[model samples]
Target: MTFKYDVIVVGAGHAGCEAACAAANLGSKTLLITMDMNKIAQMSCNPAIGGIAKGQIVREIDALGGNTGIVTDKTAIQFRMLNRSKGPAMWSPRAQSDREKFIHTWREIIENTDNLYLWQDSVKELVIKNNTVTGVLTNMDVQFSAKSVVITSGTFMNGLIHIGKTQLRGGRISEPASYGITEQLSELGITVGRMKTGTPVRIDGRSVHFELMAEQLGENDFHKFSYLDFEPRKLKQQSCWATYTNEEVHRILRQGLPDSPLFNGQIKSIGPRYCPSIETKIVTFPDKTEHQLFLEPEGETTREFYLNGFSSSLPLEIQLNALQKIPAFKDIQIYRPGYAIEYDYFDPTQLLHNLETKKIKNLFFAGQVNGTTGYEEAAGQGIIAGINAHINCHGGNPFILARNEAYIGVLIDDLVTKGVDEPYRMFTSRAEYRILLRQDDADMRLTEKSYNLGLASTQRHSLLIEKKEHINHLIEFAKNYSVKPQYINSGLEQLGTSPLKQGIKLIDLILRPQLSISKIAELIPALHKEIDKIKNRKDEIIEATEIRIKYEGYIDREKMIADKISRLENIRIKGKFDYNSIKQLSTEARQKLDKIDPETIAQAARIPGISPSDINILLVLSGR
Candidate 1:
């Protein structure tokens, strides 16, 4: 029997889960198909979520009514705000989650979401008609019809696992590789490429000598990934341990290099440059004497620990020997050896910014299947794909994010515009408007947008408005409140800042590099009274206020620049001209323009090899 739905999402990893949820929540009848129900939204690589720019992506996803941030906050066993010493734009929230609980939590949510249904099956083929995807064909011979199909196949498509000279056909350690889909898409004239990524070994925490390693503790602050406040972390917090590989450890790894699959001419796919395997690290940075590794807890109750920076694909014995050389790991015992996996990915340039495939109508791709490496990156793309798929089915404009608006925008724009030569990872440096994309204000930037699209709930929009009112009130108070030298002079001296020479506006004191809103509140009773008015979300309000007051100039400057550049974005170019026939354009420009078919002049400018002269020519042709 054939089942029908408004949307069908293939694979239940981070991307698939978000895509299915977004579509269903937007009133579409959606089905989420996965190889195994128990492993929905599995943290296949790191047990943690969010880091650097990835944390920003998670917040944007949350603001846009996605479940990843909520799930992350609920299951978090340890939470830390990274790069606190730097500017607020650099600050990112990262959490180590209860792995088993994370999966269970996601399963519960997916099961309960309105209009969403889950099927335990592997999709082997797409049921397409006239370049439009109608549904999927499962390996069990069941055909499911859908108006739109989102394929978030992750690392499962034609996956090959490598460890030393040993190779296996699997998506993950014990999971079987998915077949047929990649070949079918390739036969349909879609461009397919290979990418490689690796995970580190799981260690027995009981065998670890924690005393020999430096302990890194988690902070119990008000900060979390989700904007909506939840009850404080319920799981018992755990500390991660840091250790380093010594000369001896490096020696052992070097001795096994010949047997490593990464080096033995076995794996040819390009891997993530930023998150290279342990073997690659040693070879690339040979002059270095040591490399630091973090031992993180896999769950609250489990004794399993994951080695953060020690990814490898060496022989099992070689991996064990290399770790055993480190003092904390002198008697190391691993649950399994780390292995590198290569999988098939479609060229992301074949996708629209909304994640819809350029070749197939109503077909979308996200996550590793689109050449991205992180779970956060995958989820960000998933939410957009889900939103656009719903729009494609119903009557609405396709959803797209601009680079100046979000890190998710930057990620999608980069993927579809430039394409990926290796596994793409998110970094703060990747975003040109990161100042406008801080973790503290994702809700400010995206909640209303999602709410307008009927994705974010009314409650979320109300919360965002409330938070903004509180922040604006606080900023107004700081601007008007005056502080006398007597009131803050002595306190300023104690804090190592120069004493105030005369009375000043509280905002002036707040602008001081050494003074914070919290510190000012401690010094001035009137300011403190005004701050107390915001009792509902005191810390969040104060932090957001501080960022606004402190970086007002920078924020305004970036917005002005973003607005100026956005003018080019308003120029429509897609299907506007036959670029190949435009003899005035360079050969390379003609080919790239005709290939990418950029939607706007701004997007065309961002495309590699497209020069200023080409853009001017296009502008002239368009009578700009």
Candidate 2:
């Protein structure tokens, strides 16, 4: 059987969802093919979304009209803004989600989309002709034709799961491994490598002694993930409990370390260094007598609790013993034992900045298949890949986000240029222009671009324009409007900040380290009145104005640096450029350049062993 679609997206995880939505929403007849329809957008590991730098990527996704942030808001059981004590740039929004609800909501949204269709089958092979992807072959030998394909296979390709000495062919606990595609791609001369990731076990929440664990509650005043500002759902919130593992727990884990696939010669793949398993942690941090374990509820109603920070592939008996030794988990019943899984992924250096495979036109890759590890990171890349695929079919220039513009840009740039050896994760430190790429102003930075691409709705575009206007109006009012010593000095003094020495503009005072626009609104009635008049939406106006004033200098400096680097980025190279012909280039640089096939001079500069001399030679060759 043969079917045709304008765009075909493989996998129904976060990345596939975004890619399907983006293409479908942008008028492509899109089909989202997956192994299991029921597991669409399933939180296979943690039942949470957004953290640290990951939150900014979610906001950016929201700005670009992706469904992740909106879906997260709808399913969240608890909400918190992490790093609130730090500067606004570091403040990130996080939400604990109802896992079942999250997946159900995602499926509902995808089903409701106009041009999107769903197929329940594993993609077995890519039907490529003339060095471009034409379609995909399903498990049942059905040919699904499309002009472009976005592969977000996400740990299912040749997956192998380990539980102590026993091993199985599966993606997660029960999901079967996908086959044929890896071998087919290898035949196409694409390089593939294995990477391992593990999830923590689930335990009976009722069995844990709550009295011995510290309660970790959500923030009193929560911020929603979406910029759309949909009415917040009123649901009973759930709290997660925190306890620590004692030396006894470590001892139990140590007993099973010899059989661990990670430690033994069984597993050759590299796991995420930052998110190590329990055995690795115990072995690496030997001096530490205790390690924290968070007991997070799977849902508001479910008795199941995810055992965070205790990921392992130890024997079931050993895992139970380790859990029993934890402070509050003495009588805990195991729901599932933690296990490690290794899967195939392509090196992202094989992809261009547009997320299209360098070896094959109109074939794009995103999410875990591209070596990225987070839902938000995957979703962000999916949106970009979807947009670029649509553009590619329509004969338009590929859309690329600059590093200074959004975190998504930094993520994709890092992936395509730097080629991760292990599972890649996004962090604030990765972006030099992070101050300017604040989560608070993602709509301001990216909504217009989305609008131009037709991904953003007219109403969203209008709202973004109106929001910018409101911000400018408020900035002007704050700069010109002054508050007297009597009206604000008393409140300012109470905040441990200095009192107004003289009549000061509200904007000038807000620029101080301690004072905030919200505080100013609370103190002076006139200022509050002015703020209310200019800002119809308090959250957007406050966050946007605060970031603008607070980090203005750093933002400006980063922008200048970004501009200089962007010049190098603009120096494009022909796809057939000869790296071996350059005598002045180092042997290592030549090999690395050939491997990565960087599209620009700036990308070449970021490679590990490439030097200034190699870059200069490329610059001369490109006539820059």
- For candidate 1, write residues 4-88 as lDDT tens digits: 9999999999999999999999999999999999899999989999989999999999999999999999999999999999999
TM-score of each: 0.99, 0.97
| Candidate with the greatest lDDT versus the true structure | 1
| Candidate 1's TM-score | 0.99
Question: By summed lDDT, which 10 consecutive residues of candidate 1 come out lowest?
Answer: 529-538
Give the C-alpha miss distance for residue 482 in model 2, angstroms: 2.8
lDDT of each: 0.93, 0.88
lDDT of 2 by residue, 1-624 (tens): 689998999999999999999999999999999989999998989999999999999999999999999998888888889998887888889888999999999999999999999999998889999999999998888999999999998989999999988999997779999998889888898889999999999888778799999999986453778878657555568898888888998888898888888788788899999888989998999999998888888887898889889988888888998888876888888788999999999989889889999898999999999888988899999999999888887778899998889899999999988899989999999988777888888988999989988999998898888888878877888889877887777898898898877897878888987777887788878767867775446666777888887787888888889888889988977475778777789999988888888777887898899999888888888877
Model 1 deviation from the true structure expressed as Cα RMSD, one decimal place: 1.1
